[model samples]
Target: MVAADGGTDRASALVTSAKFSEAAQRHNFEAGWLVRDPWRASTVSDHFRRLVANRLFVAL
Candidate 1:
């Protein structure tokens, strides 16, 4: 049920399963925060840092 198609053999038209690695997830979130709210990047960065330190978001 990703896109393009959603039935038997639907994955044929799709590319990825939408699953990303831990590092990729981190980078994506950081970049998204920058693009979404540059002014609040620092605050968001600190939040993510804490999450990472607490092993809540990414393991690395």
Candidate 2:
């Protein structure tokens, strides 16, 4: 999840706590990208490009 606030620890903790079933069984749960607001167009584009390159987007 891309967060406007770059609080990776908080995001990680939230995801960690919300795990259930298959998610809970997986041990590799991790908070991925964290992008702050006031983003430039190039920066957003670059991030999306990288995510796509890495096959990170399941949709969009």
TM-score of each: 0.34, 0.31
lDDT of 1 by residue, 1-60 (tens): 112222323222212334378876766543211122333443445566687799887843
> Cα deviation of 6 in candidate 2 (Å)?
25
| Residue pairs of candidate 2 with colliding backbone atoms | none
Off-target runs (Cα >4 Å) in candidate 2 are 1-39, 58-60
The regions of model 1 sitting more than 4 angstroms off are 1-39
> TM-score of model 2 relative to the true fold?
0.31
